[model samples]
Target: MEGIEQNPVMYDLMSEMAFQHSPVDVKAWIDLYSRRRYGRFVQPMQDAWNILYHTIYNCTDGAYDKNRDVIVSFPDVDPNSISTLQTVLNDVHEQYGKRYLRRAILEEPNDSYDKPHLWYSTSEVIHALKLFLESGNQLSDSSTYRYDLIDLTRQALAKYANELFLDAIEAYKLDDLHAVAHLSEKFLGLVEDLDMLLGCHDGFLLGPWIESAKELAQDEDQERQFEWNARTQITMWFDNTELEASLLRDYGNKYWSGLLRDYYGPRAAIYFKYLTESLEEGKGFDLKAWRREWIKLTNSWQSSRNVFPVKSTGNALNVSQWLFEKYLQDLGSHDH
Candidate 1:
């Protein structure tokens, strides 16, 4: 296996499946999980879980459960850049009621996610987020509730950003430079805000990662080397030859405050800048220049030792909720 991951919620299920336990009732256990997850169960929270059960949690793809964000995706004018870039023609055609790209016998980008841009209804996730937030005031003290709230909110915002990215792509096609610039800026700004929200949780910070790597070193040189390895793994991933794409860059992408503000956020900003500039100058976008600059940023970051917060820095619940309402203000009510 290339990597491994698991949902913390699986612990309870695993315990129930132990030899000492009776036959497990999966549905009943899942229902009870909401109660066990948070200190006390609110119907709204349970309703949120049920929605999740049908939506995001319903994924069967073993490759990757989550849909990759636009920041990490190879930039494309259409939904599938890999296909268009491969064919060197606008082979974006409608089929089966959705846009599908015609790829050659061999996909150009060897390192691409096999999943579609979006697999489920983003609106359903927003609805689930609303339900999750309804009991926030009552469950304010529950740490688990706060963590789950932050996660749900992050998921909702990411989905919204994806929508904005699609709009920006459409605007680019229409040659509406103003709309594309505005949409791109707004969505990238969302990434900064997400960094702040994620910074409130320790699990999402970049500090301990570097610190842990440093601990494994015997000398300053080795420490720097280890730190570079740790940083590169999450950013540039590996060196790519002229014929091969960087197979793993951004595959381990995190929503960490320092990483987002310093790496992915700025990286995407550079991409959009070049994109708009190329349009304004009536020239084709220089992909090679972009790759060179991005690699420089990646390597520069890997070598530099920047400080990151190890402890969760703020009230995650408050920060995440404020963000959810700020971006999704038009969501109106949770009556649904």
Candidate 2:
């Protein structure tokens, strides 16, 4: 239901699983799909797909975006304030007036955050990319292969975003606002770069979404309202104050081009602004204040009449290769 077509490797695996439910030649069908997905699947592609299956597709604890990316996870003022295991040994202290956080805690040594950050080693994804790109030049211009490569690259880079957040948290704890500021920009830059990269493929672009929404309208006023509806579903999910405090704020988060830059990137920038301010002044960060300001910004974007590019600007293969050089090149070099 989530990105099966856009994710080729996932499409193949899920297709096989559907047959397994009916008791068919699962292994044989799976083998055939290997050849079917890419016309003629080679060993390198198979190896790349195998790594993908084990890492991204291997999740058994059923939940959409279970291993949530750090960007979308709740950014705590104190890294140790919230944890995946939130239980009060006695009375639970509340924050945000129990509106956002009822009783989120991390006793003793914190082992996890509010969200599951990773279920696999990021280094393995780098290895998978190394294998995937080895087949790249040979399969260059194969649009299917290029799209899959972009998907793989997207997963790897998103993990890097996790790393950036961790760095910022460390800097924040150390009272090094400068380092936090730099890391925050690096994080936002990566998201915007991802936006540009995803913009190369029309499937991931946000333009079509707004246009389709407008097409449903009978007038300009209705068109903008429709656009807001389309954008809000993915951005805020719920605009009402009560539901704004809902846990599913970023439940529908995606790496769409306009979305990353316009919504997620700006949201994170606002988060960092308040965070850095608290650090510089030697005071506790104001979560309620930040949420109010963020909500205002989100509301503005939802109704604003802005244009997103309908057509892709760059080639997926070229942009992906450039990103490889920018991010994963060091890993490749170190391996050799």
Candidate 3:
């Protein structure tokens, strides 16, 4: 299987950029507004560049064994034959770059942000590869495993939520507090949609686990055991690893209109209010502290369990479409 190094264009670009800077000039290379020597092929070229970078990132830090032969082929042509894990990841990276990344760039067309930001993280790619390997290279028929459902769902939700976030940013630029609050609440609705689709209610897992824990807690000596069991059960629902569970905990949503209006909206309102007050007092706001506070608040919301009934109906794909359409409608209304 051919890797990015085997591709002349990508190889040359990577070599040039690698020499020019420590982390490589990824932002400048993917700048869509800038004139490219490759003309119309620039988009594809940029996609290839990002794919190469991501592939290299995943292959770094001893994640990949360079000496190992390809365990999975690029096209995976033969059922009996096996290629290296790196080869499989590279193949998926190329496909992901061409499909998701290129489409996002074409759709969003914002040169301010680097294209690689739209791509999946190295851990995400590794998780997918692990799934593929665990299935003996045979694709799973399960809906959750098919087409990288979890990651794809996350990306879809992020895309929609980001649109709303951008709208909120625009409102902030205009100093329209009401519009910012309104749009930010709508932005959080995307998170609600995710919770519904994932069945993230307390009753889904936590309630049962708590009951089990309570039963175990009857003995004073079993308190620690109960805690361990509860932690194990919760982690199992995630990816069965503390790292992955932490990732999901940070990203997963348990939201509703009430929480959005009461919590997130007020938070943003207070921040903006204080920001204005600080400006009036001739004191510049501490942006670093503000960012830390924002992250802390967001994580607090994410950690909160939804004890309410699950509201999302339909399959994952269906719910995704429904939310996306609703997002479009909301964005349209906000545009006017």
Candidate 4:
């Protein structure tokens, strides 16, 4: 808390991002926490809660809008009322480190939601709070409902992915080709990490199926039909519903360096090359044909996962280091 207070830049940036038009009802939220009875923990908890809620609200552009009203409408309770909000916040802060608030703010468009201005949904936040409360705010209590390992891993991966994505965007803007290729490989490697952790390795390993599809088809159209069928089957195997598949696709296929430089880069280069060639020959570029070819290329790329041998040694730090080394090696080889 002292460290955070000393560094006002983060809070300032959060305020600028969050309070563009909608000013937070700070007094109302403070009043809500003040009314709660948590003995010695009351005031400190209120202060922490205010900082967290205000930061979240501001940084996320009011995505947690309902929480604001909910807090304002909360009824006063006796000093002995059973509540673990304070405990949960403390645990989250400790586990995630002092800069968790800032990291969370910067890591928008979280893995759960890929759309702009929808990094984290209200329900997801509420669900996390509810789990903490239900578990008596004990991080060690895994007997009941909990999100210790998997959720934390997911959050860590999401944060890393978002950081890489931001770097990639900046590199792309600058048209730094080497940085683009290096960062893209690292991003894809991270995605591979996530896929392995989530047990999505089997479904996305499309090399065998693609080879079979190729062998079974006599014509290009038949090959495409086979590929589509295989893709549909793979989708169904991984996801229970169309909505689930869509979410997976949207969140999984983030616009990272590897994807942009390797997949789109080649296609775009080929397209423009053909355009130039056609112009030189006094024939117009066949937009329809190019579009068809692009679709086929994209589909083929989408069908396969970025497969890499990433060992899970049960140590998070060790695993992260391994991934980093792999990323560096991949970049050195320029093996997009």
Candidate 5:
């Protein structure tokens, strides 16, 4: 507690803000032991946000039914309450996620998210770096910190994108490609904004994924690696689960990279089409193989993407550059 009090000016402000906005001052305890300004806070906030969102999404309160011996069921919760809580958590998650995404995108020197007014926080972080520079900290040694911040933010975004993208894919299976599309749009937008964070020189790995997604949507190639079923399932299950190792054994890491290179773009577009079809016809493909292939691709892609500086972004991109510009073009054409 004394150390928290002794912390710098920004920490004080953040703590106060957290307390004010938080539901039960739960955020304060979190802030006390946390480095509120660093990337570490991102995951915790995300976890909290998800718990709140999912709880509200699934819960209901009712007067104790003495006859039934139960207080409530999901059916008992007022829909409005669930919706309201969901909205609150979603708004917070969106704002927080976007704040970090903006910082990574703009390549802000430091990783501070100080301003709440600007809708984006990169400039604030850049301002902090300028202040740090004016204060005359050694540049070479400290420069690594900024770069490290970039990597940290990127990884955080990657973690988020990986999760959401996977969720979107599973949702698509229930004829919910619209949900998948929405998630993919968020993920692609984050990637577009945070492209620099990838540290890939050609950015080829991203390009193909985007392209294949778009192509699949156009029906230009039913066999495209990035077809919705393939891409989405991989992100949801394969990359996120133990299946990654098994997929790698058969296709090798290169196959996954190739899938990422081909599908990221087109999948976004296909997701939209599937969504529309679901709404109009209530019909959608099973996407089983698509899911399996996606698992294979994302498993490899995640490995390479997470390698940090020890891995060369150029080499990683080279493994699947053929689909680079196509993915970018599809992404460029779509709205986030």
Candidate 6:
């Protein structure tokens, strides 16, 4: 929350030197470095500063040996606060490092070049710091100095969301119709879940269910009549084509993989059973039809496998578009 303006001399020198490069003073270096690296972004100065600080003041990196004398020459800035600089760098480093791992499932193909270039939510970074503190990232730390890292990470993450959201929106804007359709379906899934999460009676209406027989036989009530009417239409549709169950089974598997991997193993097995059942009947939707369609679909899926990376440490830098290609390859193999 603190801005560079809090310190007039340091701020002025850094601001001026940022526009021009003269190694005469540390003031010039900080100015140019900050502006060149981060000033283009609206509010990323703090992040830039932490990165610069780490690069310059890192005790273990020999920065202290080369730049320490020049850095101390700056007026109104505490050379002694090198420790504070270290703290900020430590915080960023530890947090980003952990994010590299936690997001591993999303990373594939390769991550070697991507570790240092990641953008982290304030909360995620803070969570990493929390984990570090709890583990005494250094064995020398005091045990009683306890604090919640999640809260800290949350604060940072919240601020970072605007940037992330903007990026996602821009990406979506450039996406093709297939991506838009997928996004729409995902939105619909979330909206449908609201009824259940909010405990609304209408939630039950989202899924398939048979009406009570007595109510069906006796109801002349308008509300009941409307419900029965909707149900009848759906039932007729199902009986006429026998497509709903098959579609549900297929969609359920896709949704399980995308959004509910934790509960998917069992659910996928159940869905597989239903799929097998659907094929057992001498219906049009038999194994022969499945095999024919599967060949084409898996081919398409395989073609997309190169979009992601096969190796990663979950860092954004490591994440690659080539992983999509790999996915397509895997789909082809799986289909076979």
Per-model lDDT: 0.70, 0.69, 0.38, 0.38, 0.34, 0.27
Task: Please give the range of 10 consecutive residues that has the lowest summed lDDT in model 1.
Answer: 78-87
TM-score of each candidate structure, all chains considered together: 0.81, 0.80, 0.36, 0.32, 0.29, 0.17
Could you give candidate 5's per-residue lDDT for residues 85-201 as a string of tens digits? 011112222443342221212322432212111122222333322332222222222333333333333323333344454355446555554576676576556544444334442
After superposition of all CA atoms, the RMSD between model 3 and the true structure is 18.6
Candidate 6: which stretches are off by over 4 Å? 1-133, 136-147, 175-336
RMSD of each: 6.9, 9.2, 18.6, 19.0, 18.2, 24.0
Q: What TM-score, to 2 decimals, does candidate 4 have?
A: 0.32
Show where candidate 4 strays beyond 4 Å: 1-148, 200-294, 297-336
Clashes of each: 0, 0, 6, 3, 26, 35
* lDDT agreement of model 1 with the native: 0.70
> Tens digits of per-residue lDDT for model 2 on 75-158?
533453542233444444442243121233454465445555455545556777777777777676666776777777888888
Q: How many backbone collisions does model 5 have?
A: 26
Estimate the lDDT of model 4.
Answer: 0.38
Cα error, candidate 4, residue 112 (Å): 21
**Tens digit of per-residue lDDT, candidate 3, span 1-336:** 112212233554665775674665555654541124323333433443344346533344443323111100001111112111111122222444343222212232333322113233433333333333234223233432322333334434444454454455455545666776676556545555555544422322234443455466768567555644443332222332211222322122222223333344444544445444444555545454454454455444434443423232244444434554564333422211
lDDT of 4 by residue, 20-51 (tens): 67665555644464233222233433443344
lDDT of 6 by residue, 1-336 (tens): 112112233465556766775554553355454334322322233343443334323335322112111101111111111111001112222432333222222333432211111233333333333332333232212211111121222223223322222222233334333443443343333323321221211211222222332234554565454444433332122221312222211211111111121222222223223233443442322434433343333233322212211121121111111221222223322110
lDDT of candidate model 2 versus the reference: 0.69
Error of 3 at 221 (Å): 10
Assess the local accuracy of residue 225 in candidate 5 as a C-alpha lDDT between 0 and 100.
Answer: 43
The weakest ten consecutive residues by lDDT in model 2 span 95-104
Assess candidate 6 and give its lDDT: 0.27
Sort every candidate by TM-score, greatest first: 1, 2, 3, 4, 5, 6
> Which segments of model 3 are wrong by more than 4 Å?
1-117, 120-151, 200-216, 219-317, 328-336
In model 1, which regions exceed 4 Å deviation?
Answer: 1-6, 19-23, 61-67, 72-117, 241-245, 331-336
